[model samples]
Each structure stands twice: as C-alpha cells, then as structure tokens.
Target: MKHITILVPDGQTSLSSVACIVGSYEMFTRANGYWSQTEAGKKNGTKELYKIELAGVSKKAEFDNGLLTVTTHVHISNISKTNLIIIPSLVRDYETAVKGNKLLIEWIEQQYKAGAEIASMCTGTFMLASAGLLDGKNCSTHWSAADTFRTLFPNVNLLADQLITDEHGIYTNGGAYSFLNLLLYLVEKYYDRQTAIFCSKIFQIEMDRQSQSAFTIFTGQKSHGDEMVKEAQAYIENNLQEKISVEQLSSIFSVGRRNFDRRFIKATGNTPVEYSQRVKIESAKKAFETSRKTINEVMYEVGYNDVKAFREVFRKITGMSPLEYRNRYNKEAVV
Candidate 1:
C-alpha cells in the first residue's frame, strides 16, 4: 500500500482554518473506499490504495491561547519513511509556518532523498521551496503570494498562472483552495482517470482547471528596490495602446540596452518585451471583462492590429483566446 503522510504544521489552529488537513483526509479516505467498490480495482487483489496518516513535528498543535488543538498520529522521528509526503497550505504567516515546521521540512527532504514524492498544496509550496526541492523546478503558488514567493525564492520558477505544477515527482498547486484541482490531478495520476472523474462528481469540484490566469489580478511587480524598472513598468502600463519597443524603452529610461534588459528581468521576473506584452494583455483582459468591445476592437485598442499575433499573445498570457475570455468573464456579454 502507498503510505501517504499529511504533515500538519505547528501553527495556529481552529475548526474554521484547518481546511488542508481535513480536506486531504476526506479526499484520500473517500477515494480509497471508492476504489474498493469500483470495477477499476478488479485487476488488483488489494482494495486499499493508500495508507493515509497525519504526521507532525508536535504531539498537539495548539493555537489561539490553547483554544484549538490538532492531534497528530506519528512524530517526525517515529516514521521510518513513506511513499508520499503532502504539505498542506499554511494558514499562518509563512515565515512563522516555516520556522515552526523546521523539523518537518528536514524530514520531508529526508523522505524525498529516500525516494518519496513530495506534493505541496497552495502556500505549502513555501515549505517545499524552503527544503530547496523547488530550486530548479517549475512550481506554482497562489497568485496573491506570487510576488512574495518570487522575492524569497528567486531560483524557483514561480508560474503564478498555472493551477498545478509537476516536476521530477515534486508537485505544487496554485494558491488558495485550488488545491482541490491538484488533489484531483494526483488521484488521476496515482489511481485512474475514471476514479478522478468520479471523485470530481462526488465532490462537485471542477475538473481539469489548468490555469489560474483568469483569476489573477496583475498589479505589476514593483516591490523590488529598482526605481528604473518601476518607471519602465509604469511606462508600459500607460502606453499599452502605443507602439513601444525595447530600444526606445531603454533609451527613454537612460539605461544601456543589455543592462536595461537584465535589470528589468532580474527586478520584475519578466523581460522588457514580455513585460510589455503582459501589460497590454492585462489591459485587454479588463476591456474583455467590462466592455462589449469586439475582439478586433479590443485587439486594435491594445495596439495590436495583427490578428494572428494578438490572438497568439492573448492565448499565451491568459490561456484563453480573446473571444473565449470575453464569453466567460464579460458580464455585459452574459446580459
């Protein structure tokens, strides 16, 4: 049987806040029972697909002046190992979560070295990233936390628009409650697609939600201490309807071509050209959401007259064609 250890971090706890632990427990337990009764398991003799347990560094995780407590089954030292380690979303301050779960992080690294797959849900990606597992891998965190996550872990590829990321047996899901989609993906990968579909219907959760881009509110990456990049970002946002080129931007910013590109990328995690496209697409997204503009009008308004080029960039950034985006998100279109 596959050993699945859900590590409950030593952080604040309340019935209202412990969604990760409870949600994962319910999914796996219910999934195991589903497998047992389905024809999909007829090929295998054993019915139980996973041996799930909640392990933690502390005996009892209490918070709010001991008003709440989360009981753990096994201590970090008790378990020799397991097949999978799932890090749930940390509800408390991320730094606090990391500091309190230092032992759990070490254990997770040990388990990975011992051939176990690690999956982090939402902000739980922070813990896995802390372990240096995501240093050179593609990972996703909640969009709201993307800026902070990128600031802290620059080496990790923070795909803020992706709902799930799976690289080298290390998996991570986008921020917030999107962990349900990640769980469904895991169920399909570990068990079967039919089972995953069954669980989706049972839980009333949308299946195959591959991108969080539509929900992401782009406020521009300006937290870095680079004033020039901030100015460049502002210029791009202001001139979305104007034709702006890298050469002109660098010259206007009074920086050398090579240095401007490097500084902009390092500061904002996007190259000058990529940043411009994102700014334009963001403007276009707003137009799609609130305006009844035709695709052509929106395209031309965003300074893109080439049908193919605009469609391609729109799809690349938002993961949906312009028309599809308008149809789904436009309140005016719905009316």
Candidate 2:
C-alpha cells in the first residue's frame, strides 16, 4: 500500500485545516474499501490502496485557543519515507506559523528530497513555501491572503486566481474550503476518473472546478507604505466609471510616468491599467451578484461601453462569462 502522511502543524489553525486531516483520512479509507469491490481488486487481490497517517512534531497539536486538539498517529521523526504528504492550512498569522513549525518545514524538505510528493491545502502552501520548496514553482492560496503571501514569498509565483497549482510534485489549492476539489483531483490522479467522479458524488463536491477567479473579491493592495500608490489605488477604486490612464495618474501624483508605473507595480503588484481593470471588473461583479442588471448595463456602469471588450476582460479575470457569473451567484437571475 502507498504510504500517505498528513502533517499536523503546531499552532492555532483554521477549523478547515483540521477538517482536511480528518477528511483526507476518511477519503482514502473509503477509497480503499471501494477499490476492493472492483473487478480489478478481485483479479489482483488488492485491498487497501493507501495507508494514511497523521504525523506531527509532537503526539498532538492544539488549535482555536485549545478548544480543539488533533492527535497524530506518528511523529515526524519516525516517518522516514512516504509516498505523499498533505500539509494543512496555516493559521491567520502565517509568519508565526512558519516560525513555530520549523521542524515540520525541515521534515517536509527532507521528505521531498527523498522523492515524496507534497500537497498543501489552502494556506498550507505557506509551509511548503517556507521550506524553500516553492521558490520557482507556481502556487495557489486563498484569494484574500494573496497580497500577504506575495509580500512574504516574492520569489514564488502566486496564482491567487487559480483553484489548484501542480508542478514538481507540489500541489496547492486556493481557498479554505476548496481543498475538497484538490482532494478530488488527487483521487483522479492516483486512482481513476471513475473513482474520482464517485468520490465527488459522494462528497457532493462540484467536479472540474479549475479556477477560483469567480470567487475572488479584488481588494487593492494598499499596505506597501507608498502614500502616492495608496492615493492612486483610492483614485482607481473611486473612478471605476471613468477611463483612468497611467499617464493621467502620474501627472496627478506629480511623479514621472515610468517612475510612477514602477512604484504602482511595486506597491500593488499590478500596473495602473491592470489595477483599473480589476477595480472596474470588481464593481461589475458586485452588480451582477446583487442586482438584476443585464451584462451590458453592468458593463456600461463600470465604464465599458464596448460589449466585446467587456466580455473578454470579464472572462479573463473571472474565468466566466458575465451571464454565467450572474446565473451562478445571483439567486434571482434566471439560468
């Protein structure tokens, strides 16, 4: 049987993090039972596919101010080898979580060097990134945490709009609850499409959700300590219905155009034009979600008069057409 170790980090973690541990254990256990009844199981006499274990630096980890405690089956030092390791989401204060879990981080690196695949769920990506495993790799974390993650891990490519990122045997997913989607993807990879679909149906998880873009709420990054950039961000947000230009912003902010562009990108991780587009699209998304406005109505409200331009940009940022987004999010919208 393939060995699967779920790393239980020490800290005040999100409830979802603990859920990932319990959920993963249940998933593989059920997968093993289901596989045993298949024709292939009878042919090869294969029963259990994966032996799952929860491991921590210590025997147990407490969370939520000691309201909850997770007991681990094995210590990190004891598990010298494993096929896969699942890292749960970190606490809100990620820097402290990283600092506190140094042992877990080191163990993760050792395991990866020994040829074990690593998968981090939600903010668990922080642990892998802290271990220097994601320096040049693409990663995904919760959309709300994207700004903070980028500030901390500038070398790693953070695809906040992605639901899952898989490269070099390191897998990551966005959002706290989206780990279910990642679990399903793993099932499809290690088992088969049939088994993955079966698990999805059993868990009531929507299958083939490739992007978390539709769920992201773009709150412009303003903590970079650039007063001019903060003013520019406020301007872009306030003027969503107007056509804002980089040159115009530069002139208004009394900075050179090129210098302004550099400062804006450094502060917000987006060019002035891209920032404007995101702000406009975010406003348009809100209108679609809460109001019975037509696509064109919302587009024009967000300063986009051209139908093709609006549709393309909306789809690019949100991974969905305007009507589709409305139908999915707006309960009153007719499908």
Candidate 3:
C-alpha cells in the first residue's frame, strides 16, 4: 500500500523500476550525469544511444557537484507523499567524496523523518549510510566496497557476510544483482507470493525467497575444495528423515572422523553436526507448516531422536518452538 520513490543520480542504473512496481514508484533525478541524451562518440558504431522517457512523471534539471547540474530540487516538496525511498546505484568518482552531496542527504533525512522506509541497492547504500540513515542498523553493500563502507560508516552494522540485511524498515543489498532479490522480497511482503512469482517468471530469474545468506555462497560455481562439503549438505537434505552422525559421514566420504570434520567445517563454516542440525531444523520447519502432524510427529520426520532435544534445537535455531513458528509462518499452507 506504500508509494515508493526511487532517487536517481547521474548514471542511474536500469533496475530501479523492478523495485518500484513492487509497491508504488516515483523517480527523482539529481543534477549530475546524463539525462536521457545520446552521446556523439557512439554514433559511428553499430550501437546507438537513445533517450528514455519517464511515465506519469515530469522532469526538472539543475547543476551541482561542480558540473552542469540538471534535475529536480531534492526537497521535502517532492517527497511529502512518499512512503518509501529507494536509492539505486550511481556512477561516481570513487576517489572523491561525491557521496557528500548536501541537498540529497537533506532530502533523505526529511523522508526518514516522514516515516518512509529507506532502501538501497548495491553501491547506493553508500549514499544512505553517508547521510547517517544506517547508523546502528544492520545493512549491506556491494562486497567490493565492504572494507570501504566499514571505514566510512563504522557506526553502521555492516553485514559483509550476507547478500542482504533487513532490520526494521531499512533494507540494504550486497552485489549488483542482489537488487532483484531485494525487490522480490518486497513484492512478497507487500503483495503476495503469486505476484512475486509472476514477476520472477517474467524476468526469467529464479524465485529466491530465502534470506540473502542462502544464496550468497552457493552461486553458479562451487569451490573445488567445497564440493565434498556440498555433497554432504545434499546428503543431509535428501535424508532429513534419517539420523546422521559425524561417524557415518566420515565413512561415506572415505575419510577419518577428524579429517571429515575439518573438511566440512572448512567448506561450510559449520561442523558436520551443526550443519546436519540446521538441515533438520529447516526441514522440520517446512513440515510443520504443511502437514497436520503434531510436534512429536514433526520431530520424528526430521530425524530427532527425542522430542525434548528436537524442541531445544528448533527453538535455538529459529528463536521459537516448532508450534510457535508454525503459528506465525504456517498460515494458509496447510489444508
């Protein structure tokens, strides 16, 4: 139900609209970069440059950043009715402090005070954090700028390990392409799963509903040393109903217990026992939502040897007991 506004700097990337439609979207351009014009140098090549028009929106141009600025005034005047503000990645001179643009920061702060959700994609997070919007909130940026972002905003809880971090109303995504994932989450949250799925299929992208950490490490290419670890993970997923132990995994991999433990930990950042527990917990969560089974039945389905132990592990990992999680997340999944 929220109306979204996307703030475009000079060199605005193309993916901003993807997030805009997830709610309602308006585009705001700043006084730098190209503004829908073709360059003369590319006229001779087979490629051609074209101008893009904004729908249902008007354009204003100005000058700032020591260059010829052409864009609308970034003030409370333009954003008074917006419910969310999105900052897409911008092309800037990284060596200099283009992030310190005063008017832009003021507009962002005004929007925040007006109770609009603040979001950023890729390097756009730099602009938000530089405006002090991300202080004390968990956020992420493109991995390439992880170190630099930390250096600039040490007060911000920079989550370099995950592709996205959503704490309260603030959302930040890492990597350039993770913008799609963030947008999908917004669609699912504000609209519905079916709408999110429709948009995903339209874009020919995988429907990624899990948190950013789920896909961060399992990208297209798997690490060679981690192959066996992945195999172990697959084995656990396939056999969530069966009890698995480190001793069994060691034999299956044809390695000693200590060697298997070390390899699994090195590859997954979790020990074999810990990883297996996570897999079982996740499986149990799914079963809890979809089946009419009771807590004991769900426990057995996920290979928990005892109901008490299952309750403890499930609570530890999910911050809720099985029944509680089901009540919160299960809603129409079960018939």
Model 2 lDDT per residue over 227-288, tens place: 99999899888887898878899999999999999999999999999899999999999998
lDDT of 3 by residue, 1-335 (tens): 23555564533323332343222231111100111122432342423122112111224322243244334334334445566666666443432434434455577778788787777877778778878888888888765566567656769987755666777688887766677777766655544565566556655557764334322322211243567777877887789888888999889988899988987765655677877887788777777767677888888878887988998887766656778877766676433
Q: How do these models rank on TM-score, best leading?
A: 2, 1, 3
Worst 10 residues of 3 by lDDT: 27-36
**lDDT score, residue 207, model 1?**
93
Query: Which segments of candidate 2 are over 4 A away from where they belong?
Result: none
Per-residue lDDT tens digits for candidate 1, residues 1-335, read 77888887777333323677778888888888888777867657677988889898788887556776778888878889798888888754677767877888899999999999988988888899989999988999888888889998889988889999989999898867888898899888877888889899999899999998877877778899999999989888888788898999999989999999999999988898988898888889999999888889999998998999999999998888999999999877767
List ranges where model 3 is wrong by over 4 Å: 10-76, 92-100, 209-335
Q: Which window of 10 residues has the lowest lDDT sum in candidate 1?
A: 11-20
Determine the backbone clash count of candidate 3.
Answer: 7
Best model per lDDT: 2
Cα lDDT over the full model 2: 0.89
TM-score of each: 0.91, 0.96, 0.47
